[model samples]
Structure formats: structure tokens, C-alpha cells
Target: MIYLRRMDYTVIVYHLLFHLLLLTLGFSPAFCFFSSIKNTFKWGVQSVGNAVCSGVNCCDFHLNDNVEENLTKLLKDKLFGQHIAASLLVEALSSHRTHKSQKALGIGLHGWTGTGKNYVSEMIAESLYKQGMRSPLVHVFAGRASFPDGDEVKKYRKDLLTWIRGNVSDCGHTLFIFDECDKWPVGLIDVIKPFLDYHSVIEGVDYRNAIFLFLTNTGGSAIGQRMLDLHEEGVIRDKLKFEDFHDEISLSLFNEEGGFFKSDIIRGDGIDFHIPFLPLEERHVRKCAERQFELKGYSNPTGRMIEDVLKNMLYGPTSNPIFSMTGCKRVHSLVLSVIARLKLEL
Candidate 1:
């Protein structure tokens, strides 16, 4: 046998200790070492077993042809009412992904609370990223939770800009969602106006491949009035089109005291589509209840159970009570309570 040098013995001991440390930490020796190298180099590293996209030159950033089809399927299957919003979203996303866009696609969803605005946003996120909202590139910000005080608008603006710039620099296909836009401090959202503008590049980063979604309830009243008017005029709800409520909703958002109030994004054509979500009727709420039951594994929810769910929901316009006042927002909770009561009785 050949004699080994002291240096060789020391190297063997170090490697053995390193691998033992990896095993102690619950990582496979070979996988841990290669994964560390892959992360450091970030190129030409084939993922080991079941490795997900790390948001660095990964396939998750690439928009595929199936994204439109998948989005359309999800909207049609999962989302309840508001056909106008669904159609507009599908076309807008499809076009933006297929064509060469100059700026990030900015969509403003205006509606009443619990009218599927948040749900639609979630679906959009699911379609774009494999990990859905959990994806590193998909960022969600709620107004009330993110920026609570109006006094700190300046600080919020600085941090918001830095966050946007940094994320866009990392991945051009990032998706930024701002929920409860109505609650966001006025003039605070304009910090992102530059990212949403029609510029090919801002500073050194190109944000054209990104998507910005703004969800707000500021225009609920306007949308409700428009729908009521259309109903009185004998226009079928299914027949309602974008032109019918686009201008009304835009005016409401621009004049409202919330996020978009008197904002430059509204004054200019910064927002690409102001998709309106119509108030859900009783039938839509029933559908929501049915879906909730299906999701809860109660495949055959009885008619009486569904009726109980609807009875608990509040409807609107004390005179006519045409729409669900709270929409399907409380459906999940209501279903859970009903199921619990039924189990107790049984």
C-alpha cells in the first residue's frame, strides 16, 4: 500500500466531518454539497430530486403558451359572477404574454367587498407561477397591513420604490399585487407609477414583462348603481359589457378618497383595464355555498343545508334586496358552522 501524507489525512478528516455534519442536519451528503455549489454558481446545475425553481434563471419565469388557456379555465371554473372581468382579464393577459409589451400590464379591479376580487387575483397568481402565491417572484401587499399610518407616506414610498426596483431587477416577470387599494394612503401608490409607465426601461431595469394588479372596493357603489340601472332597463345581467361600467368605475376610483383618489395613475392612462366586478346575486351566493361544500369534502351537500347557508347571508337594497350584501365572502365560514351543527345533531 502506498504511504499517505499528513496533508492528505487532514483533508480526508475534514471532508468526513463535513459530510457527518450534513447528515446530522438531515441533509443527504451528496445532495447538500451539490446544492450548495448549484446555488453559488446558478448555472448549468441540474436539480437533484424534486427541486423547485429558485427564481434564478429558472423555467418558472418564462411565460408559456398554456398560461392563457390555464387562466381562462381557472376563471371559468372557479370564479362565480362578473363575466366582463373574466373576459377582459383573459384577453389582456393573453395579449400581454404573447406580444412585446412596452410597460408592465397594470390592471385595476374595482368592486364591492367579497365580490371575488381577491379570489380572481389569487387565480391569476396561480396561473402565472407554478407555486402560485407562494412563488418568490409573486409579491402581495395589503394596504391596511402594509402601511397602516398615513403620516409615514414618505417612508412607505421610499421602501416601496426600493422593493419594486430590486424585485424587477431580479426577475422581469415578477407579479406585484396590491390588495385593498381603497385603504392605501392617497398618493402612496403613485410611487410605482414609473414602473407601470410605457417606458421600455426605467433606470437599468425593464419592467415590461411584469404585471401589476390593483384590487379596490372604492367603486362598489358606482358599480352597484350601474347594475341596478341596467336591470331596470331590461338589460340581462349576462349581456352586460365592459363599456357599460368602465367609465363609471374609473370616475368613482378617481374621485374616491381611497388609494386612487385624485392620483396621477388615474389622471393618466396608467391603468390598462379597469375591470368591474358586479355584485353577486342570490343565485351566485348559492353557487359559492355549493363550491364551499365541495371543497370541504361534503360532496353531496343537501338542499336544506344550502338554504340554511343562504338564509344566514345578508342581501342589499332593503326595498328589493337584489344582491348579496357581503357576497360570497362569508360562505366558507358559514359552511363550516353548518357542518359542525349537523355533525352535533347526528
Candidate 2:
């Protein structure tokens, strides 16, 4: 009887161990873990492919096929010029100084927010960098928080100098794009004095080929108001009068808290040197739709229909040309998302 009991106990212990092993194998997260690894591998492969493409025939970057020839030439010339500075911060920067080398070219591009100011700045920076300007080509951003010295005026100057030092290259030819220029404290205009003072670097090197582009949205608010007023006066016909573009934005410089600010402004240099918001015309949009369909390995609403949908979203009822820099971006992103989805569907 004792031997039989011992045999039963041994059988029960073996059965329990076998069941535990089976449960471990069946419920293990090995499948999930492997799936994550596979996804990561695929992402890495795609990233590599994008980098190798180098802006040639890549819809991912959304580069314009009708890149302006004159703009390209102008950018190349500016990159090669000696001692260039550009901005609308102050006219003083552009005025002739007794000293020659200290002087640089100052250029200002002003429009209300949503006008694609930073977009243009990025294009310019990218163009220069591609032409071999140097690293750290575009500095981040700075503002009032950098100054806690005095009341509004003192603080503004301090903040501006701080921004200049932090952003301006003490070494190489650095092109600084001060985006959202209107938000910059009014007192900081004095800080631009040094870059404008074409005499000596307060330290050592003279800023040769270093141009500062000040993009602002506060050019003339009254003009926008007039457009609206005129429309109300029965001068304009359409319900959507071109008067919504006018509004004055005085962003507070007294920052107890720190964060990024954005704006919107409509942007085009007339028809002469215009950088159209949309890269492609109607025909190009159609072609893109077809290509998208082919890539998805199918076609529906055809490619042309898909193009019309995207076009309508970008420049139709949903579209507004007059916006601060920030506003423009929101629209751009929304349009792109819609197009991407439509591409998949087609």
C-alpha cells in the first residue's frame, strides 16, 4: 500500500510540471516581441531609402517641380557674395558705415502671419546649406525670457543681444532667419545696431556673407481694415472679400513662461518672383494622383478625381491665403494629410 501511494504522488508532480511548461510556451509574448522588431526593421529600411533619394523625384518632401530659375540664381549669388546682411529689423543695418567690411546687405520680407514667412526662410537656408554655407545654418529661436535686467526697455535690449550672441556665429558665415519678427521686443531693434554697424565685430571677426532675414507680419494693419471697409462700402462684390487679411498682432514680450510662438501670413512676390503655395498645377496634381494609384497597385475615382479632391481641399472652400506664418502651416499640414489618405485610397 505504501509503494502504491508513492507512485501516485510522483505521477501528480510530473503532470503539474508538464502543464506549467505548456502554459509558458503558449502564453509567452514572443509573437508581439517579434512583431515589434520586424516593424522597427521595416522603418529603418524606409528611412535609408529616403536619405539615398536626395530630393530627386521624392513626393515625401513635396518639392516643387516648377522651381523658379531666378530665385535659384539669386540664392546662389547671395551664398557666394562677401559680407551680406539682410533684415527689416532696422534700416540702420543697411546704411553706409564709415567702415566698408562691416557693412552687409539687409533684406526684409514682411507680411501678416500665415503668409509663409518661415517657409521661405527654410527654403533659403536649405538652398544655402546645399550650396555649402556650413553647419548650424539655422538657429532655433529666442525672446524676452533671456532678459530679466530692467523694465520693458532694458529687458528688450538685453534679450536682443542675448539672441544675437546665441544665434549669430562667432566663427563661420551663419545666416540667421529671425522668424516671427513682429513678436520680438521693440527695444531689441537696438541690438540689431551692431550687425548694422559695419565697423568692427564687437569681438574679432567681421560678419562676411552673413545675412539676417527678418520676417514680420505687422507691415500695415490699416490696409487690411480698408479692404474690409471698402467691401462693406459696396466696392467689392464677393461675400468673401479680400479684407480678412488685415489685423494687428502685438505679441507680449514680457514672458514669465517660456514656449514657442507661431504666426500666419500670405506670401507671394507678385507674379515676377512668386513662390506659389502649391508646388504643382492642375495637370501635375492629376499626374500625382495617377502615380499614387499605381503605387497602391489599384485605381479608383481614377487619379484625376483624386487630384481634384486634393486641389479643392488646398485652394477651394477650405483654403484661405491670408494668414500668419503659423496659420499657413496648419492649413498646409491638413491638406497634406488629406492628399496622403486620398493617395492610399486611389
Candidate 3:
């Protein structure tokens, strides 16, 4: 009985002494060192819901491969008829990344519907984030999806500023994608003006480490006319050049010819590269069909299915019969539908 009581007392005393020791060391460097270690490890594991930069090594992050070989390959192999946009995208991303002071890219992709504007944006994001479009640092904003109403639009400006400031301050590397910017309310894009400024920081937040991509049909009419004229002049769609779209598209945005044509971003010259996505020709549509079949691993029926998709899709400019109304946008579903019918017959 005496031995048992003595053992219990000793254990209690040891614990009390150990706790007192810890309390005494709390004000010392050792306590700070251990506390920092715990915090660094905790933050390294937690995905950080919003932006938590409260650790010794909180800013340490994986270095992403800047767009170079991967982006060029993605553009040439995946996309069909956007030579100029693809080239300009590579150039802008590469050049902008190297700029020590400005270190940001503002790309404006414009063309008729289904001209691979969104697809090109996706490719760029995919290259940056190994996990693809779902990257935490990639902020995609479509006016309809992000700001559904007037109140939401009003709230967006403040929310957007907070988001960019928080994320950029934490790591200084981020990608901002604004899809369908033409649909955004008159001054919604202007909210981003302060961040896009060439100056180092707006509110102590360095935004130079960011990339901004705007996708819209803002210059559709101009693109369609240029292609129509080229078709009439015996210029094959494949041979079309960037010089063909040098002015009409972006110039229209600043001109205020239409209500939708007024974008302060363009007027302020905030956009760095304005790459025009030309209308896709029938051959481009066929190429898209072929790629879709390749993705699905279907053989033999590929040629016939390609012909069927092309036949069903309507083309504009009855005189020329050139551009696909939906570009390759409808090609994937159309190909899938044809495959489904074929299987039923089989």
C-alpha cells in the first residue's frame, strides 16, 4: 500500500514540475522557436480556406512552370483555327513573366461565338496549375455566374478587391480570368483598373505577379466581316494572318458604337495583348470532330461522324457559307449524339 501511494505521488509531482518548466520557458527563445515550428507545420498541411499567411514559412510555395513549351504544344495540337491568338498568348505570357517591374499580363480575347476564347484561357490555366482549372489561385469570374443581379454586381467590386488583395499579398502569384466581360455591367471591369495599374502596388498588395484574361464576343461583327472579305478574295482560312485583324476588333471596343462596345479596360489601354480568334472554317470544324473522336477512342466511324456533324451545323454568310454558327462549341455534343445513335442501331 505504501509503495503504490509513493508511485502515485511521484507521477503527479513529475507532471507538475514538467508543466512549471514549460511555463518558465514560455518567455524564452526556445518557446518561440517551437511555437513557430508548430505553426509552420500546421499551415503547410491546412489548405487555408481563404488566405492565411501566418506562419514562419507561410509564403513558401511550389514554383509553377511558366508557360513556354507546354502552352505552345497545347495551342497548336488542341486548338484548330486560332493561330494569331495562340502565338500572341505565348508571347505575352512569356514576356510578361520576365518583367521585374510590371510583371503582369492583361490579355483580351475577342471573336465570334465558339472561337476558342474560353478554351484558350482554360489551356493557359491548365498549364499554370497542374491540378488544372480547379487551382485555388485561379479566380474565374463570369458576370452571370459571379454577379447574377444588380445587388450582386454592386457587392462584387468590394469582394473582388478584398479577394485579389488577400491572395496576392499572401503569395504574389495569381491568375484572374474574367469570362464574358462584355456581359459584365458597364463599370464592373473598371473595378479591376487599380490592380491592373503598372505601378508596383495599389494598397500595399503587389498585383504584378498576376495574369488577367478577358474573354468576350465584344468584336464579333468586325471578325465576321474580315473573314467574309477574305473568303471572297480567295484567301484560304488556314492562310489568314494577324494583320487581317490589326484594328477592327479592339478599335471598335473604344469607339462606343454600341452599348456593349463600351469597356473602360480597353479605353484605358489596360489590356496588353488583344488576340483575335478568327471564325472557324468547315475544315476547322472537321478537325475538331476528328480530335473529339480521338479523345473517345472511336475508329472506322470517325470519318462518317465528322461529315454528319459538319452537315448539321449551320454556317453564316449565305454568299460565302464559311463560319460555323457555334464554331466547335457544338462539335463535342454533336459527336456524342451521333455515337449514341450509332450504338442504338448496332
For candidate 2, write residues 44-134 as lDDT tens digits. 5655564544332232242223223433544344211101111211122223222254444444443434434554566555544443222
Superior candidate under TM-score, 1 versus 3: 1
- The most accurate candidate by lDDT is 1
Give the residue spans of candidate 1 off by over 4 A: 1-46, 49-52, 55-65
What's the best-to-worst order under lDDT?
1, 3, 2
Worst 10 residues of 1 by lDDT: 43-52
Ranking by TM-score: 1, 3, 2
Instruction: Give the per-residue lDDT of model 3 (tens digit) for 152-259.
Output: 656877888788778777666678898887777666677777777677877677778788888888777788898888788888776777778878875768763432
TM-score of 2: 0.42
Expressed as tens digits, the lDDT of each residue in 246-323 for candidate 1 is 778877977889889889888877889899999999999999999999999988899999999999999987766899
lDDT of 1: 0.86
lDDT of 1 at 58: 59
Error of 3 at 126 (Å): 1.4
Worst 10 residues of 3 by lDDT: 49-58
- Residue ranges of candidate 2 with Cα displaced over 4 Å: 1-102, 131-134, 142-156, 159-163, 166-169, 220-328, 339-346
Q: What shift in Å separates residue 95 of candidate 1 from its native position after superposition? A: 1.2
